[model samples]
Each structure stands twice: as structure tokens, then as C-alpha cells.
Target: MALILVVEDDRLVRRLVREVLRAAGHNVRTAVDGRRGLRLLASATFDLLLTDVLMPGCDGLEVIQQAHRLRPGMPIIAMSGGGQWLKPDKCLNLSNRLGADRTLIKPVSPQRLLDEIRDLLGA
Candidate 1:
């Protein structure tokens, strides 16, 4: 099992992701925003990061950059449902460009999310 950090603003999505990962035998920690996510990333060790693109406090792009700075080899999976101004594809593309190893659209299937994590972590 691997340790995972989930950074999402939506409560339901965050809980669902945590449950899914735990069901897959992974240890999961969650943060409501990227700011907290970064703090957690700095303070502890994690095998992967699952973050939402658009969030309050700090955005996922910033998180991605800082995460890379903090742990260059750790994998990052960026997820977004699209905000009022940006489409999901655009957000994901930007995330990829910034440093996310993988990008997923919101409402992602539990199986798909798990699969991506597995691929990233080589689990």
C-alpha cells in the first residue's frame, strides 16, 4: 500500500476519493485547499498527490510547482471539473504543462482514478 495526499475543495469529492483509495488499500490524507495540501506535503512523506485544479487559497498549479520543488520525483495527478472561466480540458492541459504527471476530469470513475494512481505509483 502507498501513502496518498488528496487535495480537493469539494467535500463530497474529497471524501469519495479518500474512500476509494482506502478501499484499494492505500493510506489517504486530505486537505481542503492547496495551501494546506502543500503544508502536508512538506511535513510528511507521500507516494502520490491527487489535487483539484481550481481551488481557493492556493490553486493546483501553484501546488504542482511547489510539490515538484519539494519532491521532484513524486507523482502528481491533477483533477478538475472546469470552473466558470476554464474548461476541464484546458485546465487539465495547463496542469500537465505545469508539472502534473497525469490529469483527470472531475466525476472520474473510482476505478479509473485508482488505475491512474496505480500506474503513477507503479502499484
Candidate 2:
């Protein structure tokens, strides 16, 4: 299994992702926002990064940019649930343009998430 880092501001979403990854036998680390996510990246090594695009501060795009700058080959999966201010595709597309290795729409299924992780890590 891979060591995965999950970054999301939504507590419920973050916990759900962490638990899902754990159940799949991956060692999982989580951060509440991109800032904390980056800090975790600096302090530890992870096989994959799964992050939500929309956040209160230092959003996922910044995380993607920094993650690539720090580790160009690091695999990243960017996710988003669109809101009144932005559409899901808009943010997710930008994430791809920036550096995300993958983009998943919000409400991602456990199986799908696991599939992506496996595909990325060759698990």
C-alpha cells in the first residue's frame, strides 16, 4: 500500500478520505488546509497527495504548485465540489493545468478513489 496525504478543509470530507485510505491498507496523513498540507509534505515523505481544490486559505492549487516545486514527480489528485462562486470543472481543470496528476469530481466513490490511488502507485 502507498503512503498518502489527504488535504481538505472540510472536516467530514478529510476524515472520510483518511479512513478510506486507511482501510485500503495505506498509511494516511491528513491536513485541514493547503498550508498545513505543505508543512506535512516538508516533514514527511508520501507516495500520493489527494486534496480538495476549494479551501479557506492557501487552497489546493497552491498546494499543487508547491508540491511540484518540491517534488516534481509526486503524484497529485485534485478534487472539488463546485459552488455558487465557481464550477467544479473550472477549478479541477485549472488544477490539471497547474500540476495535478489526476482530478476527481467531488462525491468521489471509495472504489474510484482506491482505483486512482492504485493506478498512480501501481499497487
Candidate 3:
């Protein structure tokens, strides 16, 4: 099992992801926003970071950029529901440019989430 950091601003989604990761036998930690996520990253070691694309403070793209600087080779899975502008693809492409290992759409199935994580980590 891996140590996964879930960074999402939505409380319900964050809890749901926490539950899913826990059910998959992975250790899970959560941050409500990118700033907090960065703080957590500075203080602890994690196998992966699963973060939402859009957030109230320090968006996921910025988080990815900063995290990459702080921890090169750290795997990141960027998630989005394509809020407002319906630009999921654009967000995903940006994530790719920022060096995320993978991108996942919101409302993803638990199995798919686990599969993507495993694939990215080569587990």
C-alpha cells in the first residue's frame, strides 16, 4: 500500500476519496486546499499526490509545479470535473505539462482510481 495525499477543496469529495483510498488498503492523508497540501508535503513523505484541478487557493497546477520542484519523481494524479468552462481536457493537458504522472476525471470509479494509481506507481 502506498501513502497517498488527497488535495481537494470540496469536503465531500475529499472524504469520498479518503474512503476509497482507505478501502484500497492505501494510507491516506488529506488537505483542503493547495496551500495546506504544500505544507503537508513539506512535513511528510508520500508516495503520490491526488489533487483537484480547480481550488480556492493555490490551484492544483501551481501545486504540481511547486511539488515537482520540492520532490522530483513524486507521482501526481490530477483530477477535475471540468467546472464552469467545461475544460477538463485543457486542465488535464496543463497537468501533463506540469509533470503529473496521470489525470483522472472526477466521479471516477474506485477500481479505476486504484488502477491508475497502481499504473502510475508501477506497483
lDDT of each: 0.95, 0.92, 0.92
Model 1: lDDT of residue 116: 94
Model 1, residue 74: what's the lDDT?
Answer: 96
Query: For model 1, how does the per-residue alpha-carbon lDDT over 1-123 read when each residue is reduced to its tens digit?
Result: 999999999999999999999999999999999999999999999999999999987999999999999988999999999999999999999999998999999999999999999898887
- Checking candidate 2 for backbone clashes, the offending pairs are none
Tens digit of per-residue lDDT, candidate 2, span 35-91: 999999999888999989999889999999999987779899999997689999999
| lDDT of each residue in 7-107, candidate 3, tens digit only | 99999999999999998899999999999999999889899999998998699999999898887888999999887875888888889998988998888
Score residue 107 of candidate 3 by CA lDDT: 81
Report the number of the highest-TM-score candidate.
1
Query: Could you tell me every candidate's TM-score relative to the true structure?
Result: 0.98, 0.97, 0.96
Q: Tell me each candidate's RMSD, in Å, in order.
A: 0.6, 0.7, 0.9
Candidate maximizing lDDT? 1
Provide the lDDT at 50 for model 2: 92
Q: In model 1, what lDDT does residue 83 have?
A: 95
As for candidate 3, its clashing pairs are none
Where does model 1 exceed 4 Å of error? none
As for TM-score, the candidate ahead, 1 or 3, is 1
Between 1 and 3, whose lDDT is larger?
1
